[model samples]
Target: MDPLHPTVDPARFAPTLDAGATFEEYEALKAILLAGSAQFDVRAVGEVHTARPSFPLYTASIGSRDPQAPAVGFFGGIHGLERIGTQLILHYMRALLFRLEWDELLHQQLQKVRLVFMPLVNPGGMWAQKRANPHGVDLMRNAPQRAESGVPFLAGGQTLSPWLPWYCGRPGAPMEVESAALLQVVHDELASRPFSLALDCHSGYGFDDSLWFPYARTRRLMAHLPEMFALKTMLEQSHPHHAYSFEPQSNQYLLHGDLWDHAYDHAPPDHVFLPMTLELGSWLWIRKNPRQLFSRHGIFNPIKAHRIKRVLRRHADLLDFLTRAAFAAPRWLPPADRRMQLQQLATACWRPRRAP
Candidate 1:
């Protein structure tokens, strides 16, 4: 038996996302952290206790340790069923570790920008083969934020029952362990800085990949709209052939308890905090491999080996762009004088509907 994925049967999943597969992810993360331990500050920020044993929620940082430095965080696996999110983050972490061995430019970049990673935030959810964590609360919907406007039925996050998908949790209860851990890391690492960005990797969206910014609870523009637009413009100028559809999350649909929305709102008023979701287009994978429709995991991940590799490779440039962007935020981020102009342009392109 392959010890890495022994707890869950691969036949019951897509090729790579067995319930037991999170074990492999955990072990690999440990090895990577060890290999770069000299350069990394790793912490077991929280734990997920269950009937069998407790699973730790680990966070790690490598690069400028100065609190004042610009920081960018990469997170994944908040929804246990969407293991590809975790995989994408792990892939980038591994690549960065190897690159650090000899990439002089990367070493220099690290001196200027802090990078933090939480590759697996919901180990219990992955182990249980569910989206919600051990207690059955969806981490994304566990944040203490409610939509000001109407939202999609059930999908908007409901307090009705834990059995229902998108369950926020018992009303008035504290946030879930996974959710709290994610926020803690953000507050201590990313939000504390003058300029910061977060990319929460996820999947199970539409036909094309997307990078969605905050204010998921309402059809409104965020304080960083100009910065977001500037970043988007930079992406277009830099990677002219890229395929991601960058926009506000509300442009597609709005929902309650969006963690990023809460995080952005709570960040320091003086800080430029831009949180985004890397919503991978899993439907493309499903459309290409019709057989993927039969497996629960297949709907959210690429089942074919080649497709998985392609997906893994395609996003590397974007991740790198984010790192470079964070490192050079002073160059691209709009200044006080230019924010209104850029905000107007951004509003025209993103939020045509004025918020009430």
Candidate 2:
């Protein structure tokens, strides 16, 4: 579904942050950070200023400070309307805090891997229940990368107007503050490690949930295809009937300025960085409750409490799986001798078509 053809009326998106109006989700997120401050290092990486107030962009981490340990990042709320994405990461962080008090094994696991959290990246947009930041730029589409060809009009990206959806920022302009802050966090933490994984959660797409890897700017296979295939093999072997579809983002559609693509492109070759986006399927929610199509927020998030709880539970194990995968990457990552075999398998699975 190209967001270029919005399901709901456009006027419904015109709301802005009003005087002293607090974003309840942001307040709840801050409380979670404060409660875990004793266990984690929490600091504001940047701030997004709106007409009403300036919201702090925070990056929190806990685990070994050693540069040799593997790292994993949990990111969400890049699109403000996708509130479930932000909530899921917070739920995981809160669970970690509770476990920190009693789970000795969790502490042992932390020593082997560094876990970083930036649960709410676009607070200004989230504050207004809009997908784009306060400057009206979609953080996911605000990066500097561009597609070569065959990109859908407006859907791939554009600078036509901020009033339209999927607006990539003006040509040659600096990245939005939130986007830059995320890149800095990736550089400071994930890219510095020998092996790392990042998962950025989102919703409002197809009928089933999808796990999309890098190369949103192009359909060409990433240099780390074998590693990606190895990861997929591990998941399938571990969960034979897992519900999520694991594939490349370009398989569904292409876009400009995908942050994960930008990060993978910039990371050092010696270090392996695998970034994936968890695009939860809101269409399922709407299928059960057809009226959701009329509400902008409903189109992107579960509108009911019970449904929201189910959505949270569905992705919990996957998050834990990713954490463990990063911690144990050395055990499963393909050795040089096996790289060609796995690469061949990956090509057969992901890029099956050939030119005539």
Return the top candidate by TM-score. Answer: 2
Count of steric clashes across candidates, in order? 0, 0
lDDT of 2 by residue, 278-300 (tens): 99999999999999999999999
Cα error of candidate 2 at position 193, Å: 0.9
Q: lDDT for each of the candidates?
A: 0.85, 0.87
Query: By how many angstroms RMSD does model 1 differ from the true structure?
Result: 6.6
Report how far off residue 72 is in candidate 2 (Å).
Answer: 0.4
Which residue pairs clash in candidate 1?
A: none
Considering only N, C-alpha and C atoms within 3 Å, which residue pairs clash in candidate 2?
none
Please give, for residues 115-153, the per-residue lDDT of candidate 1 as tens digits.
Answer: 899999998887777889988899888888899888889
* Candidate 1 runs further than 4 Å off: 1-22, 352-356
TM-score of predicted model 1? 0.92
